[model samples]
Target: MAPESTNPRGDLTSEVLHALSKSDPISSTEAFPGVPFESIKAALDRLASRSMVTYEQVEREEALLEPEAEIIVSHGSHEARVFEAVRQAIDGLSIQDLENKIGDKTVTKVGQGKAFKEKWIKKDGAKLVALVDSINDVTRDQLKVIQETRTHDAKILADLKKRKLLKMQKVISFRISKGPKFALEMVKEETDLTAEMLASGAWKTATFKPYNFKALGADQHAGALHPLNKVRQEFRQIFFEMGFEEMPTNQFVESGFWNFDALFVPQQHPARDLQDTFYVSDPVKAGRPAPASADDKHDYEAYFQNVREVHENGKYGSIGYRYPWSEDESLRLVLRTHTTSVSAAMLQKLAGQRKDGRVPPARYFSIDRVFRNETLDATHLCEFHQVEGVIADYGLTLGGLMEFMEIFFGAMGVTDLRFKPAYNPYTEPSMEIFSHHKGLNKLIEIGNSGIFRPEMLEVCLSDYQISSMKIETGGRR
Candidate 1:
């Protein structure tokens, strides 16, 4: 049938309103495929001169239509008989009505129910097409109307398929043409006339080629442990070889007594600022204090008294900085602010025991992750590991602590170290450890070492140490 001359889309001028909507625009040569290539090319040049449709060389994949969309393995003949049935029944008819009016095959299907199983259609039983079922084999013009009115998936695309609308057609076929230009006015063949053998099949090929790529191996491969981790492991070997027991990897989340107050960080200490420590997001039960029998009670009472005396009257031979300690501050749970808390608990375990009272000398070490808030960069990490060591014995000294640190570092092949006087609220006469990083050409402060203040030890462990050991890697900022 000839298309109507009274075009409903009106004019080319009107098409400009929907210029962007028009997909799969083909050049004149492609539009009239059966015509001689040059004649259609000349027509395209003429159309370009008058600007009917602009020509472009875009990557066709960028268009809305895709390659797989072109090859619909549709069922059923697109005969006008099927069209008439669908048109009359779709408005109010159900599947049974469709089957009765059309055929059982329309819904129950003649073969495997692959399309129906895909849920593209609903069936009352078998051999009936649903009123709402989508149809196939439409032209570009039919697709435009379907698109404007679509309330279902694949309908517009399927309609365009019915009309043989193509978003992209490879020109390789036209490139091998054997005819001259202006061979048009030739009768269009409705049926295949190539007389090609049915057994001829499609084939494809695969090959490899390189394009733009980026630098994938940018990180250095120098054989070295991660700087932070290397430090942590060095810690474990150092203290274990020094005869210190390993501290608990138990709950790294610690209460105020173990984290701050136990370590002599006063309730008012600015270091307890939220930005300096990570606090748990939720609240948890803090249990009742450990029970103290009369003997334990006397020991606890005695430790508290001595600690108070040291803080107020210089029991350690120096007047301690006095600040009120709050039990609430001791209750807050934080990332174990220091591995020293592990040692503090260990001491509490060993408190009140002499070699005669069945207590043995003990030292301990911890190599674990610690966290802090810091600006992130290649140089600064928000969380890193630390190496901590504590010694609990009858007679340990600051000189012994220094010798241990030097020996441990030396065994780890760390040669360059320096110690300078520093301060920790929990330690007395503290010294900060520094290392020389030859690559950076600067003296890097490595860690801290100090004698734990007697008052701090008494609160955490409530045991008066004849001497205390405090060594830490990754200093508190």
Candidate 2:
């Protein structure tokens, strides 16, 4: 092995631009010897894009997940957290470093299983002495449950059974049946049927074709969707079955007017930042266009009125949001950070016609990709889909929200859940929903829900009445 270079360097592009200005089309070997040619080509293309060079970049390889990397970072694992923390702490430790530290070992063989077990016990005697006390009743009980759940290897099962906490009870039973009758045999020379002479006739030699009978393949597993995704599909189907029209799919690139400003999010809040959301290449945010002058005779004046009412306060005699409403800053564009964005859009679609008599009990659902600059981890992705739904009409309340959440989770095969107070700009008295997972022994925050605030209502509904009314303000209770 040779020692690698550790010299300080100038920008590759700056170097390339300087050389290209003076040299004829130089080959990658001339440009970056000892460096990968593909990297050299990329620098040239970037330079060319800015009119600094005349070369194109060819991609050498596509990025792929390493098998070992995938194993240590898959979701639903607390183990990954520890693994990552330990790996980060071990600075300057390489695979070769570990190998050198472990040194060489003598491989031994034993024919008998018991001999191998004895050897293992003897080798790890000190560790076993320290570990024996921690393997208490609860530990054994949990291990038994896990073994039963996994149905692992037979030897492992036997070891588990030997632990004394493991138990398998046998129940024996049998049923009697009618015994066989006369003996039967195959004979090549068949003769005289239904007569005593044919009962015991001489048989001729018989030969059969050679058959190479071998064991084939094993059983196949049925394909299935993930449980979370199945729940999302169910919600989607729920809305599709209802007559309420689905909202437009333009939210992934919606303006602040529809996402935050129209929905009454305080501009000073910390959520609207690159750290929390993805900003688009362009910043031309749009807002709910101001309604025509109060003196104008436009028929669409009623639409803006509904939006204003939703933001200013709750409709239908509900206590309106008391915050000073501003439409000027409501037009910034970014990723649809949450499915709550869909609810606002849905309300806009039903902006008018409350006078026509269609109001409360309006139902809508959306299961689509939403983006947020989340911390990527085993169970979390940079962006993921959410199942968003809302049922609106007069007399909708927080109890209804809780009831729907329970029913929805139950239908999705999640029987255990706990709720905590959460705040969302769109939903007043919002809640963060937590579900208990058996393995982890603690509640995991799964989703969020809340009753839309009056301002939210005004923004979404046409027949909204902006007045004080009874409502349980959302909070951690």
Candidate 3:
């Protein structure tokens, strides 16, 4: 009885280490015959990662016999078999008899033609007789040599491959050698030190894996500001370059008294409706405007009364909306619908007398978030930023305002501006600013600008001061 053969792969890694211990370098194919290439490669890789073994892949083409070539190796070549069967016959074998004897018509037919071409056989009145008494059977001999050696000359290999008797396959083997940390026994590597190792004093003798500092660490995916904020910063820089002070718009929540009434927006305006504005619910009522700090000496009561009177009745040489204005509506807390609200508060602060007994001309700008109760769309949002600017001085006119708008927009590479006459409740002769868009082949409205109406500025500035102010709003679009 034959003994059961053991699987070489069962202890491939240990076998490799043991082999490397005896030899400086060993061929995996010669050391581990009948083992799978993948299994040997996996074992070598495992040892290499631990720095216990190193190896180089050795690749070559090995000739493998096909079924026909294997059969020829076991038996003789097809043509040789045909010649032997014919020579063994007492009289000679007929074609049909030869086919029956060989049990393969294809081999018999092909061999018969080859034998006739080689003059090894001749036709004797429909009987096949051998013309030669002895035959070499070179094909069978060559295939046998290839079966033992797995290769021959390149020309012979090509011929054999063309004959479909053999095929060439890429065989990968490894040349393994002892690495720097070569060992017959694998030791457990410590990736990190623990308290237990320190307590036992085992760290001194423990083998720790070396760190690969060259390896790239995992991505952190750091944070960044939104595109709107980046653009806001750029606009702020431009405002600063133009001598405009940045208003503190951190107060997103504001009373209607500052957001609307001070801006000359009537209480009955469509913009004040629940569908158009976001009204805060908790602590719905807000206190009336008062001094921001002890140093603030602005008359908030007088400014508050002036706003109420302007909206309720005529004020500053113009008839007001003449509708019943509610103090509750004025003091209703809401998410500010515009940064213009901040502009309004700043303007009111300028109303107080300075050391010169007059309000100084000022340039102010704000870029911050605003909330609106509106249907969301690609071009519209419930909350977005507004870029607004205000300039107050004497002798400022519409022409100067247009020129300033050109220079402001030009600084940001916008040109060919066209202003269309429009109207706003707070700004007389309002203009909707548009710039020619070459891509759209038309003008697109980029912002709105106008001078503050006398009715609106009267409550915020002294009567003796005829101030002209231009508001550039919605430029963020």
Query: Can you give the TM-score per candidate against the true fold?
Result: 0.46, 0.44, 0.56
TM-score, cand. 2: 0.44
Regarding TM-score, does 1 or 3 come out ahead? 3
Model 1 worst lDDT window (10 residues):
172-181
lDDT by residue for model 1 over 1-477, one digit each (tens)? 112233233233223213323433332223232444444334444333333444443221111333322222233322323444544654444545545665546333322243344333444444334443354533333434433443223555555445444242333211112123222222222233233423452111222122226526678879887765665666666677778788875677877656765566666677678877777767742433453365553254454445445544444455655655445555677776667777776676676554454346677887777766666897777776677878766677888888978987788676688889988987887999888889889888878899888777655444454667778876221
Candidate 1: count the clashes: 11
Q: What lDDT score is found at residue 476 in candidate 2? A: 11
Question: Residue 429's C-alpha lDDT in candidate 2?
Answer: 82
Superposed Cα deviation of residue 271, candidate 1 (Å): 1.0
How does candidate 3 fare on TM-score?
0.56
Which segments of model 1 are wrong by more than 4 Å? 1-234, 288-323, 357-359, 458-465, 475-477
lDDT of each: 0.55, 0.50, 0.85
Ranking by lDDT: 3, 1, 2
lDDT of the structure predicted as candidate 1: 0.55
